[model samples]
Target chain A: MIRKALIPVFMLMVTFPIALLLLLSFGKSWVYPNIFPDQFTLQHWNDIYQINSELLMVTLKSIGISLGVSSVVTLLSFFSSKHISYSVYKSRWLFLAYIPYVFSPVILAATLQFYFTFVDVSGTFFGVILAQLFITYPFGVLIFSNFWNPRIKAIAELSNTLGGNSWITFYKVVLPLSKGVLLLCFFQVFLISWFEYGLTALIGVGKIKTLTLSVFQYIQEANIFLAALASCLLIIPPMILLYLNKRFIFTNQQTI
Target chain B: MTNQLLDIQNLSKAFEDEHILTQTSFFLQESKTLSILGKSGSGKTTLLKIIAGLEKQDNGTILLENNDITTLSAHKRNIVYLYQDALLFPHLNVFENIAFGLKLRKINAQEVKNRVTKMLYDLELQKHIHKMPTQLSGGQRQRVSFGRALIIQPKILLLDEPFGALDVDTRKQMQRLCKETLKQYKITTLFVTHDLKEALIMGDQIGKMQSGVLKTFKNKEEFLNDPSTGIKEEIEFWKNIHANEE
Candidate 1:
């Protein structure tokens, strides 16, 4: 019975904040002790794009950098896990999945800050993406470990027996078969980089500001309505994504 | 010797100190089926995998049509192993699964379509041309697997208990399909099974594996007459049980 109630509780936890944000975005100067706003207006929602044009640009940039990070990390971690899994010595190095994610992203960024400066990408978009990869890439690597199992290896060998070269088999069989996990990894990494604050601030030196930083900026300024709008913006994409593709993270059956 | 399609000499393999296959030698004639009977853990699957070049044997020479293919890679060996699991590529449609080998060989799309369509009709899976593996039944999955294996026209077909996981009716149906497919393709086949009935039903020549060693007989009579198989006693035991029940 309690378990049945938990979902309703969770739904309230999600919708109550969004409901308040919706009310705030439309409220005209809501203040404490005013159970309802003295006036209702679309002022904040209307001004969201017009007055806060920079928020729009920052959100776009956030998406761009997150996609870049997701793409590179997907490929990088794929090859990383593939190499470690397919090592000639047959020694499994699953530890690669742990190390990067184990470290705090801020500490990881600070540790690699000097190297980013030497590479002349610090305070740049590329540097910001690199900082986020420190967390996302390990997750991708761990997600792809399932693709390198003995059953899958046997499938690869079967491909070979059917006259496919390694490259051909990878393209036709391995990649197609792993499409589910790959999409999962890509979106998971995208969400991580999307909401990422610490690494972006540290490595980009606050120059490459994202929407997440803008929400923080509004909070610090005590602009509750704008902060609520920006927070909703940050939360909305992942919510829609999770709703549309729940199997991308949750399913256990190994079908494509 | 001229009739021989595959010949193995002094084959041996071990995992740690546990010997898996010991001096296993066999000869398969052109277009003949050789069935090996062994219990689980009797190294039946390992032996077939070694022959298909998926696994390396510690000592052996495999000659296919008088060519030494022992050092050849699995890709170059022209031998295909059908896993008992019927591992159809889950993402691919039935047509694509059947066309997988030809596509890998870089066959043209038109030819691939022609061949796959014909194979689909031949396997009586024309209605499921666009269906994924998950949508297929157990028997349909095996037919698709058989279609994939036979469409390639491989030099040797190694079947490792292809019917092991099916129910009684499905297993019988699969055996019929296997018999029809092999007869149509005329592929030299190495079929390993623990089922005595399946062994006799599938093989032109019969062999048995015991304690990592293999013995092959020239014909079914010879195999049935062999004392180690316990076929005589097995029949008598069933007969006596029936008598007692009566």
Candidate 2:
């Protein structure tokens, strides 16, 4: 009885904030000391596609950037982690992977901003993508390095002896075995690139307005309704990813 | 100029200051299994690795069926090295795991299906063909591993204490199965083990490894007579238990 009773309460606690965000996005006259909004409207939601609205473009750009960064980072780091894991100086190499995270992403981006500007990629979409890779790539390596243990190495060797060339071994054995970890790395790095503000701001130079930046823009202008809508939009992709992770990765992980 | 199917001449290896294998050489005729008996760190694994082309020898030539495979990459060597752990790919079901090598060779789909199905039946795993690696028991997994290796028709199969992780009964069963299967296939094998009984049971040609040197006995009787092989001590120890019980 207690367990059943606590379940709904827990779910409500989790969903309450989401509900409030949705309500606030639709709210027209919510003021201090008001238990409920005096009125509700769809005008704020309509602003998403209105003429001259940056919301739609910014949302699409954020999706594109996050998807690109996550895909590249996941692939590069998967291979990089395997090599580093098997290297004689494994710990030394892993320590280097951790170096980027030693400072905050913001500080790291600031330090790297000059290098980005020097390369003539500053204030560009590609620039923000490059800047996010600096952070997410190392994070990916850290996560995937743990995936390559002695057993995994032995399995790869086993594949080779079974007449599998390097490509065959990777495509047939390693990749299939690494599915769960690969999905997890992609999702985590996606989240990292999605919410990244500092590096995006520093490298983008305010010319690139991602959904995250738009949320901040609305908040700065004291437009709470629009800010709430942007926040709601920001929450959608990760929620879908979480659902995917739970549905596919974790389910497959039970067997792995 | 030699009848040996697999030949190693003056194989030597070192790791930094420590020499793992020193001037080791052996040869096995076709369809023969050479069981190498060695304790931990006896350089047995290093020897096997070099032959399988998984590791490079500091100085040696490995000839497989009269071809110098000394510089061949591991995948091209057709020498399968089986570790103690079954190490089945977790994502693949039993059939897929067994078919893995054939698939890599791009064997036709129908032929791949027939061979894997036949191999599964031979390993008595047809009923569990769809089961994932995680769903199988330890012994079942090892059988699958064996099937996976054997399906490729390897030039030589190297067993590095492949039954080390099983319980006594399973080990015996696997030993019997391995013996029967190898005989049926006439596959040359290099079986490495620390277990005395296992070494005697698994190998047609028995050798003992100590301090990076391999001493392949002329015959089983010679191996048993050698004190350094430890069979006498093992026998004496067992006889004492029987005497005490009497």
Clashes of each: 0, 0
Could you give the C-alpha RMSD of every candidate to the true structure, in order shown?
Answer: 4.3, 2.0
Tell me the deviation in Å of residue A113 in model 2: 2.9
Clashing pairs for predicted structure model 1, backbone only: none
Best by lDDT: 2
lDDT of 2 by residue, B5-42 (tens): 98889999999989989899889988888999999999
Query: B1-246 in candidate 1: lDDT tens per residue?
Result: 428999999899999899999999888998889999999999998999899888899998899999999989888888999988888888788998999899878899999999999888888899999998999998999999889989989999999999998999999988887888788878899999999989999998999998889999988999889889979998888999999999
lDDT of candidate 2? 0.91
Worst 10 residues of 1 chain B by lDDT: B1-10
lDDT of 1: 0.85
Best by DockQ: 2
The parts of candidate 2 lying over 4 Å away from their true place are: none
lDDT of 1 by residue, A24-105 (tens): 6566676788776677777666665774577677878988998899899888887777776776643445675587767788
